[model samples]
Target: MGVFSTTSRYSLAFLVMMNLCLKAMASESDIDFSFKNFGKVEPHLALYGDAEVNNHSSSIQISGSTNFSAGRLIFRKPINLVGANPRTMVSFSTYFAFSISGENGDGLAFVVLPVEFPLNIFDGGSMGLLRDRKIKFLAVELDTYMDKTYNDVNNNHVGLDIETPVSVKVGNLSSVNLVLNNGEKLQCWIDYEASGKRIEVRVSKFGETKPVDPLLFYYPLDLSQMWGDEKNGVFVGFVSSNGNSSQKISIHSWSFKSRMPPPRWMHSEPLDPDNVVEIKGEEGIRSIPKRSDCTSRVVLALVFGAGCGVIVAFFIVFVWIVVGSKRPVAPEELAGKGNEFEYKKFGEERAIKDGDGNGEK
Candidate 1:
């Protein structure tokens, strides 16, 4: 009974250790998600203002026919900045296909804001990004109508704005003869290199690669400073608006990729697994380091110990079964069996001697 109790305890411990190992392994793996087609509204995206998923056209319509309508679509998860320093920037790349129709007044923009749920700014010429001037954000605006009040270059142009309506850098979309409100699909690529502190923006007709010379190239665009969050993370999304004239802005497809650094709590040595892992928006598989956290190391030790314990328990049970099967018989039964064996041996010897005597005679 005591042996059985010990074995049972070891078995229970082994199961518990294995469970912990599995949980730790699951936690160490990074999360990667993608949505090829927005047949329905994605759970990871939050639609505020006038944004709605249009299944009929397989797109996200930001604004419809209503005047003074403003829309914002935000990614629910906040992207982690690379490091603690103000200059540490996170690298990102995104490709999107969009179209705008009707009387395009205010236009649309791709925004990176510090707050997950940001307040709606002014409508019309502000393009839904005019606030109390305290909001820290950046944007790439595709202006389809000229706003003289905002110092817009022309009706067709792309501008990079830093926390205000007036852009620090502007590029004429007419240089490539690209039309925004013509109901034609347009493709745009935005790439940010944190190491070089460079941003490249490309726009072209649908189904075409980025031009050799990007439409807009800016340097020293540090996103970490623009984010200005306690954790230094930022929310990315799109915003659009319509003034007195109404328009329809739709996003047919979008893909976002970024590299997320390790969390703050995991900054200690030995147990700290502070490795950069890239999260591809379309691809699923990526390699993760072995010692990503203290939990992983603990789980690994537990798994090894449990495996040894299981082997020892199995050996002990095998020895016990063998010893139990070879138990000695009763003494009286042994003596009786020995006597019958001696009597048979003597009779065989006597018969052999008689045969030898006969042969001699």
Candidate 2:
């Protein structure tokens, strides 16, 4: 029994430690980042449609009077999906080269979605490029119109995005940096139109350009692999949609190419397990969540110790009363009534109590 108890104690301790490790890992997986934007122009996009990359210039200007719930303008180019995921982490910062001809209700959106190679147009800003894998590169939208579909509080708010299950807001404005690097990071900022007077924004691929600020991302990439298909390349372009209230936005230029990012990590499938949650810092920085660790251990020790102490105290009191108190002089009816009570005695305490009562002064 002693040996068994010893093994059980250690086993329980190990299990608790393992549970802590698992919880830490699960929390780590939940850390993510996203972005924000301002409505400078209506939402628009470029559908690589039948446009010949060799024949046409890479950019196009969309012109229209804005007074509709929404509309789409697409400028498409054919490109590649380099890494493991045809999808790449996309970040966009939008600017209005010129202002809205009318401003009561006007907004703009930037998008990267797949379109049928010829040309694909659905209800502008409605399908939001529905189910069109070719035209839908995960998109960033600046919207001014509110529909029941978006559940917007009003047309003034901005949002971060997700397509399949639902679309939700992330940040609000005219100028914002929107980033999506998988689920772990989705960050954004929307520039207030009031502040638009003195604003400048830039977008580049940390692709070919060396970024002063580096971004680490994972893509369906093949560094040294061979590729045979030309259409398989990535396509990126600008898009806009206008509401019944018209707005025009001009994009000066945009660029894309690959650049070396900071060292990053990926756990291979069926990965070897020790601690799956990642924590990075200065080389010598403490590697744990200090306050959390301290509080958790303190709380756990108090809980376990308090619980065990209460139980042990109760057991001791029970045993002491059994051994230290007159054992009820064995109630006459229960005395020796069962095998376990076979040696029980009758009531001496009752007789003593009756005598004492009669003699009370």
Candidate 3:
């Protein structure tokens, strides 16, 4: 049939060039912004020191009372945290909406460092991080100062800073009556679950709802040892300080998201190896297909090549209907007629006359 319509038009132009090369390798350098109302800021955000932007209430103040103030706001790109496989790790979530008033003396974090770090190394109780020590971070703070030198679990807590500043899990905002420095507007959340290397934290009091537990939990955090793999990338914002008291710190609304870890055939449940916490040279936390794409392996290879071309066209129409039913021919072999041949009528007479002469024309 015109060579199967020229082999189905070269297999649909090779599946549209393999679906544009799997959408450019499952392209995803994800990071989403929301800022419901930071009015104008956003020049891809990367404010440093005393961060600003408060067009009459479209908040963002991040550290003001001054006494040795410091601030940051980050997000000038570096995202990717992990996905083109490199020992898989990539999952995130964030939300913000802060507020803290004066006299709290230090606190406010949520970092993830290493994107050439040094936005000017910080000081004063580590909220603005990097009091150097071979810098490496991954914070969450929100402290409010009680610093007995990093052992603070009092001035309204919620910690989890991993490359030091001491808190290896703290959370205790007066057990939930919530009071960070009392200026009101709270709300925080943080998630990260590259298949249960887990991490979760939550808080409330802004518009409420979104607190089904998790007031801090950290476990096996193998964020690929914090940016030393998957081709390095990491830099997600917010930091603050006001150490010797004079604290302000505002920051109204914010958002963040990241993903990549779903393809275990789209998992339908089975990740409870006792709530997975296997870390120690990590590996095997299964789930790989968030991005770095193959468009679901090219849509399952075009549905397995159209179901194997409809099972090879139904096995070539079942061998052409069993060779066209043995090509027809048996009505008693077309009514048996051939054997009556010797009907030499006109020849009979000539033969009789010429028989004796042994020849006849």
Reference-based TM-score of each model? 0.61, 0.36, 0.31
Q: Which parts of model 1 are misplaced by more than 4 Å?
A: 1-34, 84-87, 116-125, 260-361
Highest lDDT: give the candidate number.
3
TM-score of model number 1: 0.61
Per-residue lDDT of candidate 3, residues 1-361 (tens digit): 5445555565677679879886666557456677777877888787878888888989888777467788899878788878777777777899998988847767788888887778855655467766756768788988888889878879899898888888889989898888888788998989987766788999899997999998898777888876746365878888988777787888888889887766554444324444434344466455434433446558876887898899789657755554555554656864644443344655687778788677543
CA lDDT, every model vs. true structure: 0.75, 0.37, 0.77
Candidate 1 on 40-154: residue-level lDDT in tens? 9898988877889999988898876588878887878877655445555566787788998857667889988786444454434367665555677789998888989779989
Provide backbone clash counts, one per model: 0, 69, 2
lDDT of 2 at 160: 37
Candidate 3 deviant stretches above 4 angstroms: 1-9, 12-14, 17-29, 32-42, 46-49, 52-65, 68-108, 111-193, 197-217, 220-236, 245-257, 265-361
Kindly report which residue pairs in candidate 1 clash with one another: none
Sort every candidate by lDDT, greatest first: 3, 1, 2
- Candidate 2 per-residue lDDT, tens place, 219-275, comes to 222222222233344344444444444444333333333221211121122222242
